[model samples]
Target: MNWLRRMMYGRYGSDQLNVAMLVLSIALLLVSRLLRIRIFYWLSFILLVLCYLRMFSRNITRRHEENQKFLRYWFPMRERWYRMTDNLRDCRTHRHFKCRNCGQKLRVPRGRGKVSITCPRCGNQFLGKT
Candidate 1:
């Protein structure tokens, strides 16, 4: 592992953007293969190249800036994905509701009857059964 560490010593190395690009590339490759689409193949190749280029880049500052920019958009989507998974996992144990005023997400325990939900964001009050 000494050689690998030395090789990456001055490189930007891996980041979330790199991993996301790799996954995107694989997804594109699968779709391209299944659909026999030439455009997706090219897009996947481009993504792979970009991923490698970012990995091997010596400009750490630029890479960090790029990663921060990527995260600005990635984080919200990631949070939503996490929330969806959590909701699915707790489907039997908890109930999720959206605030009618601010659209904020609220969670209450399952099987609670006629619970009054107060929206923390907009201070809206509503009654619902959990």
Candidate 2:
């Protein structure tokens, strides 16, 4: 453990991008094995190698920039995923709706019969039953 810690010192180490790469590589490898695809195997191997390269990189600034770049594109999708999961979890307690004009998502408490929903985005009013 001492040796490992010493080796990791001054390295870029792991971040969300590294973990995503690792997971994607493993998934690709599994799919390749199941489907017997040579291309997927090669792609996964390259991805795994990139993950390790990033993990052991001495260029901390470069690695951090790369991670930030990845996050720029990933954060929005991640937020949507969290929102979807939360909505699913709270399905019994709340009713979710979409605005007709702006397509904005709105949530209301369940069991509110014949309620008027005014979209905050476009100020469009619609009637919904909870």
Candidate 3:
């Protein structure tokens, strides 16, 4: 059991959203089984495997194409996973700033907007409005 945990621990990206995908994939597989949906099992299982591979896989274009072809067969569920992975792979970069005093990074999604933040660690204020 401990070995299984250790093995799977770093199998995917360590983030809230990525962990959510792993959990949701498991739930989807189980639900598909309970509902006696044969295609659902395959779709969910494939999505689960791809989701794990994403942790190490690069060149998202191939994955996106594969997922797109898979989505043609299963529209609803597969589409969601496809879009989710797509969004993760293709995210817009925003202006990011950090406080030198406290080293707290702040993400401003306004695309180079005027923003200011104070360092919570040292209470040092600066004009971060980039």
Candidate 4:
């Protein structure tokens, strides 16, 4: 692996943006194959090429800037996805309610049978059945 290491010595190698691109490319490829769509196939090919180009790019500053910009958009979306998944996972054991006063989300245990919920943010009192 010495030759490979030396070849990548000054390259940007890989980052989250590259990984996301690669994953998107693969997903598109699968979709193209399953649905026989030529446009998706071409888009997947382009994304794969871009991913490789970014990986072996010698311009570190530009690659870093691109990755940072991607991250600025990715993090909040990822957090929302995680929060949604967590809520789905917790649905069996907990219940979620929104405060009518300030639109704050509140979680309560399951089977609580009409309990009073107070919003921590706005101190709004509401009744919810869990």
Best by lDDT: 2
Tens-place lDDT per residue, model 3, 80-121, is 899988766544654556778678876555455665666666
Better of 2 and 3 by TM-score: 2
Model 4 lowest lDDT segment of ten: 105-114
lDDT of each: 0.95, 0.95, 0.64, 0.94
**Model 4 accuracy (lDDT, Cα):** 0.94
- lDDT per residue for candidate 1 within 1-130, as digits (tens), equals 9999999999999999999999999999999999999999999999999999999999999999999999999999999999999868898898889998889999899897998999999999999899
* Clash pairs detected, candidate 2: none
Superposed by TM-score, candidate 3 places the C-alpha of residue 48 at a distance from the truth, in angstroms, of 1.3
Q: Least accurate stretch of 10 residues (summed lDDT) in model 3?
A: 10-19
lDDT of 3: 0.64
Off by over 4 Å in 1: 85-130
Q: Per lDDT, what order, best first? A: 2, 1, 4, 3
Can you list the residue pairs that collide in candidate 3?
115-129
Q: Write the per-residue lDDT of candidate 4 for residues 26-121, one digit (tens) a residue.
A: 999999999999999999999999999998999999999999999999999999999999878899899989999999989888986999999999
Screening candidate 4 with a backbone cut-off below 3 angstroms (N, C-alpha, C), the clashing residue pairs are: 111-130
How many clashing residue pairs appear in each of the predictions shown?
A: 0, 0, 1, 1
Per-residue lDDT value at 111 in model 4: 89
